[model samples]
Target: MANNNVSAICSCCSEMDGIFSRLLILTSSITRRLIEFFEDILLRDVNRLLRDSEINSYGQSQTSATYASSSRDCNSDTSIAFLDRNASDLDDHHSLTNSGLEIVNRNYHRGVRFIFKGLMLPLYCFEFAWGSVIASWRCSCYHMRCMQANMQSFVSRIVKTLHGSSDDIGWLQSAPGMAPVEDGSARFVELLQGIRNGLHKLPDSFVYLLIPGLFSNLGPLYFVSTKRFFSKMGLACHIAKIHSEASVEQNAWELKQYIEELYWGSGKRVMLLGHSKGGVDAAAALSIYSEELRDKVAGLALVQSPYGGTPIASDILREGQVADKETRRIMEFLICKLIKGDIRALEDLTYEKRKEFVGAHKLPENIPIISFHSEASVAPGVIATLSHIAHAELPWLPQFPGEDRENDDFALAARKVPVVFPVSAAMALSALHLQLRYGEKSDGLVTCRDAEVPGSIVVKPERKLDHSWMVYSSWKKDPEDSSEVDACEMCEALLTMLVELGEERSN
Candidate 1:
């Protein structure tokens, strides 16, 4: 009886050993297959990205070739100026064609890629947990190391392909052949002081065109107060009515026509002072239509303009960037479907687009250009400030069928309300991000480096002012606001400096 019991115990022990062996084998096989599958996926994705990069490279090469051919054609033509205009139009079309669908498709794929990664998150976690266990038992970290190496390589490749070659990715830095930036801070101060003392006034010989930036159409009060202030000072100031969300070239054409009309009507040269993207649009107008606008325009003041490029636009729109597709999709929906604006309106401000555009069309050296940029304070108090973005008038309610007769007048009156925004908080957050990530100083949207236009007088103000500070009124009063350096006085100073620069250049 004892021998039989011992035999049963031995048999049970053998059976358990076999079961454990099979389980080990199964787990090992599953782990190996998962590793292989993930690596294969990584390989395929990398290959696809490479192919896309090559395709984009080919497209850019073709564009350059076309531009060269057009230049040659223009040079050969007897009517060079007219042909130059035609060539510029062709270049605009090419730019639209190249960037439009390609950008959309890349963004869609990026969003899809994000969804895919989220869906596979569980699998990824499981694999990592299992991988660690396998590594412990086998005492070999080779498989995990290999997977990590591949992942790092994959990420590096994506960044490389997205930004192009290392040499081509210097959009944040000043471009080669760009004119050196000159400090106009001292002169600007003098001018500001002069304005405050009523010693300096903007010349009445020119029609001051105050061009507002992106989405300015929605904000009826944008630059309205400034215009009123200018009017009070007996200046012929007018706010441009162009669609702020239109493409740079499109707006430029409209601006050119506007400048011509202003010049023809008043027999006075138009002095343009554009804020944010409006500055970019105004500069584009002068650059593209230099021949026609040489005598018609006196000067340009690009206040907080991203003349070079803005990293906000570039990072959001650049392919292979993390969350690039998701951000682009959101922007496209907002700008395209919701606002009925061109996506190119945002794209044109990107580092890549700005580099290309600025390279192709140089700003005419004849025009006196002033570039003004300031840093936004990211202090905690700034987050609490509110800004007026828009104004809305509620429709008057008709007194119908004897309803609430006593309060009818109160109820029926049209309600005028200001649309306020926490723009200061938004600016603070973005400024913090830029500072943390790139260590670059920005006015919430445009970095100091980006706003400094080549060959233009650059003014770096010590005052901490956000991008909207110039155009939008703040709910919270600035404690440091001096009696002399208000927005209107600052405008007067900039134009006065510009007028002096023009005179000096003419002499």
Candidate 2:
């Protein structure tokens, strides 16, 4: 009977070992597959741009020659002036096209990083589990604590590496011929770079933080993708790279600690900025931090943040879509690897709870809070123009139309027509929802009305700057119309506001 029991125990142990080995193999294969997929997507997109550039070179030469010939009939002085102006305009157009292509390339690279990170999720989990198992086996409290600390350091390194790689990807994807625009045409890029430079100069005054929204880890990538534009404008920005799956309170606490370190007990004001769920984090931190710490805040900028809540989040939660085992696993994997924190997972929290976390939180009345949003519009004419240009056919174009012609009034008007089927459908639904719901002003993801805060100065430029482009600037069409501004100009506006506010306070 003892011999039989020993044999049975051995068999059970063998079965368990086999299962563990199989899981490891499966995990390895999945990670490899995801990496390959990401690489393929990035390579294909980059290759396409190289091909388009060749095609565009031929077309630009032809256009330039035509413009030169067309101006021959005018008076010599007038013709000279016309030729210079025409050349400048062409240069601007080329620059804009190149910028757009750079953005496309950046997106592809970012997707690759996101997928690669997603694959790392299972490994991260396994590492955590294996460490826990070893600590349990040894039954050493000190060893367990050391292992936990090691795990924290390891995770921090992973997050930092991911953020750095993501930023490098953006810088690598920037167009080779694209020069920093010194003129007004490059205002937005210049402004963003200026902000970055300004922040770097006053490192003591800035505390870089991350605010994440629901979905995946795309938020950081989204920021990284636009980093070039911002860098060009002068903003030396960095992401905290905290995963979206992290609890809001935890994220807030971590950011607060980081801010404290940066401030070093000095009363220097720090700028807090976030996109989507990150915005929620900024608000939460401001709300919960000690009053003395709150006084250290100089400004809060939120990009496409839904302080109220996003309808998409409500839909995902209501449908129990996030509850599927496979879906949750996939999201967890991605969140661990690609994203910083999980905002949607907080779906368990009541709307009131979320509101209390984000909305009820108030900064000092003196602290500047600036909010920005994108209005969806479709301009067929601009689309047609972009379609004709071989190099400007960006992957994100169809979804984000008004971006290319952000400074053109006519383009803005054209966008109001609803060109794409999805946008048209969304527009129709939005109209009905607005009528039924009464005064609801959302652009599908966020409401325009809710995007605003009381006493906060809102700058709604006439151009239909999409959610992403609000931070970056596009070329303006009409030279005379100064109303439509880009990111660089926006930076100047912000500075002007600050100067004016400072003067008022002194008075």
Candidate 3:
């Protein structure tokens, strides 16, 4: 009986160990799949944009040489000018997107290797270590706690070094026909102070640029969270409130002048770090500004900027479709009231309007840029409770009685019968809109491809990180190894770019 009991206990231990091993493999596999999905989405979007540009170029070449070659005539004709403008826009768009894609691919392979070699295997070891502790209660908890403490200390050391004070933050400063960094630190400080002072009496047309995505407008919140992350690195830093009712261009111009007045006026070159739409604005500014102003820009760090535009936006603007009353109301609230009233009014502008502003600009090839992006995933059990609440509060459709419904024209058009039931239609439209709004791979608003710029240093954080949280700068008391890795990567990239810019000036 004693032998049999011992045998049963040993058998149970073996089963648990096997199960643990399988769980670790499953988790690693899921992570790998998520990364791959992001890569595919980004690659496909880029390839499509390239194909479209090529086709458009080919089509234009087939047109009469007289129309194409007559530069003065082309400038005069609005239609020709429109075509020419779009072509140029498309060309630049293609270049930036392709460049961003290359960066994404390079980092993606690195991320894959990091996950497999650095994270997964280590995680497995951790699991085994924990499992051994679980098998015996005698001093096991104490041992586990010690191990955890050691890991925490290791992580803290790395984080502190990478995100340390920016007191020595260095970049090349350029004046007209000259570039130098002798007074880089002093100049940056003076520039920051001037900008802050200028913001006190901001012009009505002057708008602080708002980048779209989560945490974009959470000002103080973002500062507290991210201040330490980049503070010690001597990078340029400023905090400004975006104005209500200002156009995107107006906002861009305001930021442009602010940087110009602060950095360029003082003979200091500048670097702009824009997240999401802010990135678009930075690129747009670079395109339209004078060569002198452009020359002053050392680099642009775009964190998940969608330069190619978003498919979700395309879905929202689908032609000939009338939005349901509820949908329209939500749109009005989000666009007119929230964005226009409180935030900048750019979000309310039509895609074509936004495109028009962006269409007029092109980034100079000489400037180096780094882009960071995050992958989107729909977790199986995760529910977007906010969206659900928004849906629940919407008014029911009147035309279709005995049913709770939201009636968009698209939903109405797809009906098999003359009178679609309200409840069924609402549920259908709700599901469709939810999928369009929250479904698929997106960091809320921007797709992975749209989030990153081509040829920029692209860092896709661990899965489950939302678009807004990618730039989160909160300090961790007991930071994980992965977190330290992320901070180090960002610091290394930023430092390398600054070094390169400095070198460029020396030459």
Q: Which candidate is the best by TM-score?
A: 1
What tens digits encode model 3's per-residue C-alpha lDDT throughout 198-252?
A: 3221111111222333224533333222333334334444443444245556656
- Using lDDT as the measure, which candidate wins? 1
Residue 364, model 2: Cα distance from true site in angstroms: 3.4
Expressed as tens digits, the lDDT of each residue in 192-288 for candidate 2 is 4555445322232344443444443532233433344335445444455555566667767776776676567544455666666666666667667
The residue pairs in collision within model 1 are: none
Candidate 3 stretches greater than 4 Å from native: 1-215, 233-236, 264-266, 317-319, 324-329, 338-358, 381-440, 454-464, 474-480, 483-507
Ranked by lDDT from best down, the candidates are 1, 2, 3
Model 2 residue 484 CA deviation (Å) reads 6.6
Worst 10 residues of 3 by lDDT: 166-175
Residue 225 lDDT in candidate 2: 32
